[model samples]
Target: MTSRPLSILDVRSAGPAGRALCVEETAVFQHPLLEDPPASAASAEDRRRYAILQRRAEQTCLACPLLAGCLYDAVVRHDVAGYVGGTTARERARIRTLLGITVEPENLDTLAGVIGGNRPVDHDEVVRLRAAHPDESLERLAHRLGCSLSTVKRHLRRDRNGGRTREQEPRSRPSVRAVLATARTVLDPARGSRRAA
Candidate 1:
């Protein structure tokens, strides 16, 4: 099986949603968190500086024609290396937590190419654990799975967020045949790019 590499920029270039807020325009600005060395020690100063820059960036974004598109892409995709859509990386993380959204970190590695859908934990295993120990706290669940607390929360979030539904619980663990079938679905370059137009 083969995979065609699709850069985020290339996909965005196909559509004209966020062209106005390119990285170059925002590169000159410094994020307070990144700029401040002793952020914890300089809490008051950091907050002031952060507020000023945040306000300025947001104000600029508000005036841009591409504000909505930029914000939508930035926050949804978790592109928090620098400011876009007027929000810093930390701010975007906050937004994600509030919105019940989970942007897989692996997706950020553009060089790795597109990963269709991969979860760190199997859906069925999570379901089994939850069913077996209804009284367990999130921390305990994480400890049991040998995964981070956040990973456990991510697995269990939003009705088992990326886990299985009740209808699919009976067959939570994928069959070997099913796994092979999924593997066979990947496009092979030797087959001359099976992508449909």
Candidate 2:
């Protein structure tokens, strides 16, 4: 599929509270895609910069409150840009295939804009898909679910071990922006100076 820019939000549905806790407000605004793309033609330093940027972008997403919502939207709409829910556009397509959700023209509409129009991937579908394809590799399963392989393993293992997937529990304390900054500095202290805006 051709890459196209998505609004990320079709509406301010999550509102201020959800928006405030978003990780995009941190490092992602610097690049069009959430992460910088590595190019073989580029210098070694350039490749390293891209890698650092991608890692920090992922770390920011991990700390966001609306991660689930962001991921769900990306998977449902076949988002064509950025690291959403830690999955790329190709991964989202795999998920859409697994969930049996056809991407109709109107699938682009936000859930807030039109209720009951899109089918988001659900936990049950994930479980069912895993069960139906028991021999499938965890990475394949994660790609199908638009999640990390570890997550696929965790959910299935947790269930088998008699534990439910944990909810997005409230995080205890600390500023997200500050934490994000610290992570970036740790990864590459001179990122700003090393790369020109």
Best by lDDT: 2
Which residue runs does candidate 1 get wrong by more than 4 Å?
A: 1-18, 21-24, 27-40, 43-47, 106-197
Full-model lDDT, candidate 1: 0.45
Give the alpha-carbon lDDT of every model.
0.45, 0.48
Lowest lDDT 10-residue stretch of candidate 2: 3-12
lDDT (10s digit) by residue, model 2, range 50-169: 666666665665556565556655555433344665455445545554444534222222334332454444556668888899766556876877654434544564567465533222
User: What is candidate 1's TM-score against the reference?
Assistant: 0.37
**Model 1 lDDT-worst window of ten:** 5-14
Q: Runs in model 2 with CA error above 4 Å?
A: 1-17, 23-30, 33-36, 39-43, 102-197
Model 2, CA-based lDDT: 0.48
What's the lDDT for residue 108 in model 1?
A: 29
State the lDDT of candidate 1 residue by residue for 48-167, as single tens digits.
Answer: 766566556655654565644555555554333445654455555565544445455322212333222333555457667878997665557767765544445444553544533323
The C-alpha RMSD of each candidate to the native structure, in angstroms, is 17.4, 14.8
